[model samples]
Target: MALPPRPTPNLGWSLEEPRNEGNSLSVVERRMLERGKKEHSETTLATTRALQIAEQCQEMASSTLIEVQRQGHALDKVEHGLDAVEQDVKEAGRLIKFMRRWCCFQILCCCDCFDPDASMDKSRQRRVRMRAQEEAAMAEGQREFHLAQQAAVLRMANKGTDSAYNGNDAKARSELFAANIRRKTSSREGEALPGLGYGLPDDDQHELQRETQLQDANIDRIGTTVENLRLMSLDLQGELESQAPQVDRLGDRTHVVHDNLTVLAKSARRV
Candidate 1:
């Protein structure tokens, strides 16, 4: 009777059986966990695929940048060649001009020796004027040829400008594509997956997000590089355009010197 009375005073004692919660899970919870694992695996797989694609894009961009640089170098070589041609033309013009002046002086001396008091007849003077007019016309033609060459160079420069614009547009598109990928990744990160407790570990998810962020940074760097290359192309095109007129002038002067030599040769033969 005393023992029964003591048991009646134990108010904190539990009557229900203990459950093995640590060793067993409900069927629904197990299925939910399985589903969460499946979804997480799929998400991880998709993220990996996206990363692979991003890497591929980066590689492609790198190769494209290399090609653009090569083209720029080729253009630089062409510009140097043009400079050489211009220099050679100038030297040729100077030599021709000097030869023409020397020939004219010799022809005058010969004429003075042959006919000291003989004045030029009207026909001879008219022919001389006509020959001078012809020389002027030849110089004009030479100028026109030089202008045509300048125009051709301008056209080429315009084409290069257009190509640069196209590259810019492509770069914009690439940036937009990178932005969309980042947006999608960020949105996915914000979403709370169902039964996340049974899904990928928090550390794993954070690592994946870090990798995605790194990829995004790489893409941004690539876009910046492409933009810089495009700017360089534009600058080169502008430089080409600016220099075209000077080259044209040099060409015109060369042709005029050549014409003067031809006229001097004819006058020398006549004398």
Candidate 2:
């Protein structure tokens, strides 16, 4: 079956790539564009994963509510299941964030490639920056949810609410507890859930935090890289401008010199 067309992003950009100058995109611009398209799709896929996870959470909540209404039987299982749901949610959130940053980066590249207007590009860049901020906010929110889930999981484990959901390998145990819920939801889920931050200890929860810091450091390097690349692009343009005259002179000299050398060799042979 034919698929529906994807809607254009509301980037206020309808300007086609400058193909009239050459082909669809210059080499550098083409790379940037491909990165943008690639990252955008990944972002969309990550977002879909997140949504599916959210729905999983909702279903878990609903089932727990139903169980509560019944007789509070197996409440421990429901709590363990909720912790598992929380873990899955955190995993989805991390992917959403990781993809968002790359998505923002690629959007900037796309804006630069397709738009000659500096003002427009700057506006778009600013928007992407804000999007990055939103991603950061989301990371913070996920941290809170994880902390809550961690506390609940710990409380339940200490009370021996669910021995099957605890141990030195709490992550694996919790995952085992959550597995049934995942199976129930999988048929209704859109795509594969993102796999990240699995089996992290409470002390090791800082892994994603450290990664975020490193990414921030990398963002600082982007400014330096862009300045250098801009200078190189300008240098290339200048070199191309002067190259025409130098190439003409050199080509004329080499051709005449080669012919003269050939003639001189012939004369030498005759002599």
Candidate 3:
């Protein structure tokens, strides 16, 4: 009562034989051929993956280059705008300084020409002018009186041929008129000329002379101050002009350094 057939041992087949190898190679050759084919497939896949990664790196670098170029152009435009703004500001400063200097010059002219208390000074000058006119009129009156006396003498001489009494009356009349003229002149001479104001300005002539001299001095001082301001403003303009190129160069160097750093970063990524 035993089993009819026991299981057969696979003794004829070589160890580790892959399926469908019997038609092409011996046992050892089939094993080596399978390993070689697998290695070739793995190498091909690795090469394809490497090619794709290289293409990706190239695209990234190209895009980065375009972006860096665009940024560089933008930076240059920004620097140009800044330069233009600085120039505008400098010009405006120069114009303001010029206007201020012109105003200062005008003020100096005003100080030289106009008095602060013009009304009071004008009143004093008017009084002085009136006094001068009065004196001139009085002198003219004296001359007229002298002429009248001479005319009276001539009349008396002409009338002497007619009567001595008439000549005497004419002489008396001439003497009386001369006496009246002398009395009026003496009275006016004794009276003091009235003056106005507090102290120095009481004499309008002296005050006018002093004010003219003071005005001249003040004008000179103000002109000197305006000249100094102009010089300082010009100096600042020259400094700004001289430094403008250096500032632009510094900005360019900054962009150049950024570009160099970007190139180095790209190279590192490739490594």
Please name the candidate that would achieve the greatest lDDT relative to the true structure.
Answer: 1
Model 2, position 223, has a per-residue lDDT of: 31
Selected candidate, larger lDDT, 1 vs 2: 1
lDDT, residue 20, candidate 1: 36
Evaluated with TM-score, which candidate comes out highest?
1
Comparing 2 and 3 on TM-score, the stronger one: 3
Off by over 4 Å in 3: 1-28, 101-248, 251-271
What does candidate 1's lDDT look like per residue over 74-170, in tens digits?
A: 4444444454445444444444544554566655755544542233321444645675576566656655644443343333223222322333476
User: Which ranges of candidate 2 are over 4 A from the true structure?
Assistant: 1-215, 262-271
**TM-score order of candidates, best first?**
1, 3, 2
Clashing pairs in 1: none
Q: How well does model 1 score by local distance difference test?
A: 0.49
Candidate lDDT values, in order: 0.49, 0.44, 0.45
Q: RMSD, model 3, all Cα superposed? A: 58.0
Query: Tens digit of lDDT per residue, candidate 2, span 186-247?
Result: 44343322343234333323444343333333333333233323323343354346545655
